[model samples]
Target: MTDWIASPLEWLQNYQLNLLFSAVVVVVYFIIRRIVLPKLEAYVERDNLNQQTFRSALFTFSLLSAVVALGILLLIWGINIRELLAVSTGIMALTGVALFATWSILSNVTAFFILLSHQSYRRGNYIRVIDVDNYIEGYISEINMFNTILITEDRETVVYPNNLLTARATIINPRDRKRPIGKIEDFRKTETSVDGGLNDKD
Candidate 1:
């Protein structure tokens, strides 16, 4: 038990320079987590970003930070990062070729980030996609990694690909201090009238 405790102390004394470098790395990681992450989270909250988008961004940032920290630790331990990166790149290239369908998925993911940055529309906002052949107007119900769901006036749900949405022109109706053109009561009344007409015919 004493040997184990003394061994670590002796190693630390012998490797003072390495220990100092490691301490610096740990301090930097904590500073980034404490200072940088909170600032990013504050910005996301200020923009009223969706939970999914915020989580994705946060996860990406954390993953990048972990990778950087691992690289620094590897260098501190005298590992050759260049050879490791080269091997990783080769493996990634092969994986990319095998998962060619991933390109489409990646495009949708990329568009999701673009949507967050653009902030043109959000869930619960009314929007109209300007398409001559396939026009769509509805309230955004959800924004996912690959699709945006909209609920129409007719109670129909439409799923639009994120990539397609990014390419199209969209008109957004923000929640300003103005009366809504159509209320939920109006839709309810219309539905009741339709049901009544069907009953009368029966």
Candidate 2:
């Protein structure tokens, strides 16, 4: 045991190269997180998505990034990649069989990520989800990890799955756009059309 304590400098000298490479890996991971996460958070805010879902997403992505960093470290330390793949394969086989029935849940979670990146879509947007058979129109209330909460014009609530929403063609800004009018035109326009069109009143 005395020899172990006596060779601290020798041990560091032997592994200094690996340690330096590991430090580089760690710094790169942190740099990626610092640059990417804030932009994601900004998109979340701009889209008015659920903050709770954002926190969940952050945790999930961080876990993924940690796993990737660990894999790189294992490679740098001369660990056999095959063993890592074997263990990963075994885990996947178990989870895949167990989760076969609930695979849609995974799809919904992934679709939430896709939906989260769309900066133009917002919680307050009046959107129409159109499919071959029919369509549903509503204002987006909240976008959670699994489903989107929509409030219809009739005040009825629709809980739509994220995957389905991503599959469908969504019409945003379906409402009419109006041109800005000056004071003179504003005074000239005494009434609006009952149909919500900008027609002059007789």
Which candidate leads the pack in TM-score? 2
Where's the lowest-lDDT run of ten residues in candidate 2? 177-186
Q: What is the lDDT of candidate 1?
A: 0.70
Q: Evaluate all candidate structures by whole-model CA lDDT and list the values in order.
A: 0.70, 0.76
RMSD of each: 12.3, 10.8
Cα lDDT tens digits for candidate 2, 1-202: 9898869978889999999999999999999999879977987888877679779779877986898798789878978779978987896686565433234576677677788888546889888787663667788898887889888777788898888888888778677422211122332354433434534332
Q: In model 1, what are the clashing residue pairs, if there are any?
A: none
Per-residue alpha-carbon lDDT of model 1 for 13-122, expressed as tens digits?
A: 88888778988998999889888677656545655656676777678668767877876777787676788678768866764553233346666765765665565666
The clash numbers for all candidates, in the given order, read: 0, 0
Q: Candidate 2: which stretches are off by over 4 Å?
A: 1-6, 87-103, 175-202
